[model samples]
Target: MIRTRFAPSPNGLLHLGHAYAAIVAHDLARQHGGEFLLRIEDIDAARSRTELAEAMIEDLRWLGLHWDGPVVWQSTRLGSYGAAADRLRAMGLLYPCRCTRADIAAAATDHGPDGLIYPGTCRGRDVDPAGAAWRLDMARAVEIAGPLVWEDELAGPQHATPEIFGDIVLLRKEAPASYHLAATLDDAADGITLVTRGADLFAASHVHRLLQALLDLPVPRWHHHGLIVEGDGRKLAKRRGSPSLADMRRDGADGRALADALRHALLPAGLSLTTGIGWTT
Candidate 1:
């Protein structure tokens, strides 16, 4: 059975972009007689708000998207992520990095698709593991995993080249697991067969595919849909004060109608959908 999930962080309210993504995932599952799951990515305890999560759930329900079974919270899966990290460390594919963002920017000579690539400053450093963030040795990992390819529903087949992101952090100092580690593990744990989200994360999928191989997790096909942007051509984001679904609900907007409009590409005033990998609106 195909299983798709809409994992949302509870750091802020759900906006139109989130609603559209959730609807796409939900509709895909329902149309194919598959299971639609919901996951609360609340690993960032410092910024994660319980109230926001509750509101998000309410908003999803109000938008007529019902998920199967109870919601899975990432905060409760720290041990699993830690064990996976330990396994990678044991394989000599993981290293402790004490370099901060400032350190990397100062030493970085080249930039990849995912910002400045780390100059491997702490690759061979004998830093204490407990006080430093853990980074995956991308070159070593790819070598061990051998050649890999992942399928995308829209983009078709894709070659996995995780080195584009350089050494990715599996575990951050502030969070138990980084997005790459946590999401990859959770998808496998939940038996997800299809991963669907915005196209903005298409590049990140390369990193996730590498993690799946390193952890020996099940590989699932991906579908990176387009992003919803405002009239200014900027993608709708909570941090940018984009109008939220909750606010729309409070203002008596018809949730079902709005969802239908989004499905048919008939967006509201000042909002448009940009398809493909790069969202240049």
Candidate 2:
């Protein structure tokens, strides 16, 4: 049986972008007689709000999406993430990182697909783990995992090049696990057969694919859909002041009607959809 999930962080409200993503995941599962699941990515305790998560659930419900099982929260799966991190540490695939964003920007001499690549300043440092994050030794990890590949339902076959991310963080000092580690494990734990998300995160699949190989986790096919954008082609975002589904619900909009319209590529005025990444507003 096929399984897909819509995992949203509870740090903010759900916008049209989220609705479209959810619809894609939910409809894909329903059309294939598969299961659709919901997950609250609340690992960032400082930003995660219960009231926001409650409202997020209400928004999805109002948008005519109902998952097959109870919602999963990242906060509850810390133990599993810890175990994975321990395994990587034992394999000498992880190192303590004490470099902060500012420190990295100053030391970084190269750039990668993800952004300003870390210069590996803390790679050989005897950093105190008390306040340090855990970063994957990308070179060592790739060597062990060897040449690998993954497939996307839409984009087809892809060569796994997680090195583009350049020694990404696996465990953060403030959080139990980074998105790459937590989401990958969660999908496997929940038996998600297919991962559906936005094209904006398409590059992230490479990292996730590598994590799967390193952790000996199941590799699932991915379908990276497009993002809902604005009149200026900026990807819809909460920080961009995009219209939220919650606001529409509060105004008594028809949920099912909105969903059907979304299915047909109908969007609110001054907004559009784009399969490619758009600039920030």
Candidate 3:
């Protein structure tokens, strides 16, 4: 059976862009007679708000998107991520890194899809793994995994080139696991057969593919749908002060109508949906 998930961080209110993505994932599963799951990516305990997560559930339900089973919370699964990191550490694919963001920014010479590519400042350093951030030795990891390729529902076959991300942190100094590690493990654990999200995250899939190989997890196809953007072409984001669905609900906007419009690609006035990997809107 096909399984797709909509995992959203509970750091802010859900916006129209989030609504579009959720609707797509939910509809795809329903169309195929598959299971649609919801996950609360609340690993960032410092910024993760329980209230916000609760509100997101309300909003998703309001949007008429029904998910299967109980919600999975990342915060409750720290031990799994830690054990995966430990396995990588035992394989010598992970190294302790004491470099801060400032340290990386100061030494970075090139930028990749995910911001500055991390320079191996502490790759072979005599730093203690405990209490220090752990980074994957991408070069060595690729060597172990050998050549790899992943499939996308829309983009077709993609050659995995994780070196573009350089050495990525698997475990952060302040968090149990980074997004790459956590999401990869979570998807496999939940038996997600199809990964769906916005095109902005299409690049991150490269790093995820590597993680899946290194961790010996099941590979799932991806569908990176286009983003919902404003007239200025900027993707709707909470950080950018995008109008949230909660605000729209408070203003009495019809949730069912909104879902229908998004389903048909008939976005609200001044909002547009960009096409996915191999398709046009």
Candidate 4:
């Protein structure tokens, strides 16, 4: 069975871009007679709002979508992520790094896919574990995992080169697990055989594939689909103050008609979709 998921963080309202992504994932499963899962990625409790989460759920429902099972909340699975981190630690694949954002910005002389490539300033340092983040020893991890590859349905077969991101944090100083660790483990646990997400996160799949190999997690084929963008070509994002689904509803838009139009690619004026990988990292 082709199991897929729509995992959204509850930090902001669901916008048109989110609606498009959700429709893609929901249809991929339903059309294939498979299961569609919903996961509330609320691990960052400080930023994740319960009200926004509720509103998003209602919005998804209003959009005429359904899931096969109960939703999974990331905040409830901290222990599982912690255990995975412990396994990596035992394998000597993880190291404690006490570097803060300011420290990294000051020390990093190179940039990678996601932004500043972390310089290994804490690799040999006797960093205190009390307030340190657990970073994956990328070089050592790649060596252990050996040459790797993961395929995307749209992009075809490709090599997994996670070194571009440098040593990524698996466990945060304030949180139990980073996005990479938590999402990888959650997909496996949820039995998601196909991962559907935005093209913006296409680079992230490389790091995820590496984590799968290192942790012995199941490899899921990915579909990094087109993104919905506004007239200015900026992606419709919550941070950018895009009008949300709830906003649309409050303005008296018909929910089912909107969903139907999206399904048929009848987007509003000045909004469009593109398969272009917006960024490399």
Predicted structure 4, TM vs. truth: 0.96
Return the clash pairs for model 1, or none. none
Residues 93-129, candidate 4: write the lDDT tens digits: 8889988889999999999878999999999788888
Model 4: number of clashes?
Answer: 0
Q: What are the models' TM-scores?
A: 0.97, 0.96, 0.97, 0.96
User: Scored by CA lDDT, what does every candidate get?
Assistant: 0.91, 0.90, 0.91, 0.90
Segments in model 3 whose C-alpha atoms lie over 4 Å from true places: 278-281
Off by over 4 Å in 1: 278-281
Q: How big is the RMSD of model 3? A: 1.2
In model 2, the runs with Cα more than 4 Å from the true position are: 276-281
Residue 55 error for model 1, in Å?
Answer: 0.3
| Model 1 agreement with the true structure over 1-281: per-residue lDDT tens digits | 88999999999999999999999999999999999999999999999999999999989988888999999998989999999999998999999999988999899988887789988999987788777899999999999998889988988899988888888888999999999999999999999999999988898888989889888899999989998998888899999899899999999998888888888889878988888673332
Q: Which stretches of candidate 4 lie over 4 Å from their true place?
A: 278-281
Question: Which 10 residues in a row give candidate 3 its minimum summed lDDT?
Answer: 272-281
Clashes found in each candidate (C-alpha, N, C closer than 3 A)? 0, 0, 0, 0
- Judge candidate 1 at residue 269 and give its lDDT: 89
Ranking by TM-score: 1, 3, 2, 4
Q: Tell me, what's the RMSD of every candidate? A: 1.7, 2.6, 1.2, 2.2
lDDT tens string, model 3, 5-118? 999999999999999999989999999999999999999988899999999998998899999999999998999998998899888999989888899999999999879999
Q: Where is model 4 poorest over a 10-residue stretch in terms of lDDT?
A: 272-281
